[model samples]
Target: MSTELLAVRPDRSLTDGEAALLLELLPPERRERLLWQAEQREPLCAYGLLLLALRRRLGWRSLPPVARGPAGKPFFPDFPEVHWNLSHTAGAVLAGVSDRPLGVDIERFRPVTPRLLRRLGADSAEEALGRWVRLEALAKQSGTGVIAVLNRGLTAAEEASAHDLTVFPGCAAAVVLGEGEAPGQVRIWTLEALLEGLAENF
Candidate 1:
């Protein structure tokens, strides 16, 4: 039952294994988004699949369409009662769903370039960016795009006063799931496990 982290490919499109799994779960239009760029497409599609699967697992009829806020945070329209987050990095994307406000992040284990760091932000600024990442991730989880909620003034940092922010430095993606309650627990699973489960069900 041990789950090791799986890497996603940015350049490659979704694999047949992934595509087929998605096909079985997603409607035709939803499945079309899986083409191109693992960096963006794969994770987003996977997130959609996960949401659908979770709805089925929980016995919900359907989830609200993904929507974004002013600062580029994703949210659920139908299930305004639930909070969620989504994040994608070099090779992987992570998503978290909960009844409380939550944020999840993953960063690939790589050195931060001085130039990128300089432009991105400094200590507090970096923290703010991190917060922004969580916020944006939340928007994605809600099924909304980041641009709708992308903005400034949000602070980052693991210890920030923010509710439930989960950071996964290993893969390089951050997510924030915010709703009625802050998360009291979290479950971490490898992308491979999700894919395997998807494949088996398909």
Candidate 2:
């Protein structure tokens, strides 16, 4: 099964009208979750935009109903053949789509606390963040969340199976695919391209 990963850096130049247009396309649940803060809103909108793009790519007639897994991971309930996961941080949002199970995580750079480092069992801040995203991505891949995996930790075999994705500077991202599945090419989407795609598809 092929996997496609898309990343977008939130555009600060979007006009109020354009923002409304995008917001209108989001489901009521997603639209209501929009934050008053621009920083928060950008990544959320990016997630919605990515969902629209993925739907079009898969030739879905409309946005499918999303259901939460037992561990809080989201999935398309009616589209069992399509698997996807989304993650967003301060300045970037990431989405991964595949024919089989997959998960993706992105985290912006920040100094790690000594307490957090110890909790993550990492020697340094960078290592802690890397390990954090990997563990989180792995949890997502299994339809579980980080809290669950942190409690149990990954098995040795699970540790050996994840793929670390190349991301822009100042951030870390990782993608985890089902065992034996290879990740396909990474795609970086421009804000214009995403907006254009939405206009065409919607």
Candidate 3:
């Protein structure tokens, strides 16, 4: 079964021209939503990275229509068999696709306290964040999110099943695969390079 994960920390901000060109490659819905998300002033758009993942993994130039699950997880209704997920922090964006179900998340390095670690049932800050991301990825996969996961929590095997995705430095990411699935190596991208690639595709 095929599995793909991607991470991109945009090396630089998009120029006006670059942004305009990128809009042309996106589906109409994404263009408007990306614009809405841009208002948050995040370094990169998760949707853009999501588009890159789809193109690179499945050779699809644009997304079909999507619908959200009960928990607000987005999926392609016409392509239910194709499992995919996306996430982003101010510093990085993550995307994944696989033959089996999958979910992913990304976060930049930050200070964490012992108190916070205790809440996550971890002994150290790094372990806490790692556990945090694993919990999030597992939550995303299960469609109930963190709150629910916190209520019932992970088993030893469930926590063990979450794999770190090697992307850019100074970020934490994890992906959870369904039964019998294994993770693929991650591919990192720069926004400038991605823009150039999109231009070539046009």
Give the lDDT of residue 124 in candidate 1: 44
Model 3 ranges off by over 4 Å: 38-45, 113-115
Residue 3 in model 1: shift from native, Å? Answer: 21
Lowest lDDT sum, 10 consecutive residues, model 2, at 35-44
Give the per-residue lDDT digits (tens) of candidate 3, residues 1-202: 3877777776557677877766666566656777776442232345566667677777887777767899988788888988888888776788887767788988877789877777888876667777788889999988877978977978877877789877767778899987656786787777766667666666
Model 2: per-residue Cα lDDT over 90-153, one tens digit each:
7688888888887888898789999899999989888888888998899998977688889898
By lDDT, the candidates rank as: 2, 3, 1
What are the lDDT scores of the predictions, listed in order?
0.49, 0.76, 0.75
Cα error, residue 91 of model 2, in Å, equals 1.0
Please tell me which model should have the higher lDDT, number 2 or number 3: 2
Candidate 2 — which pairs collide?
none
- Given candidate 1, what's the lDDT at residue 67? 60
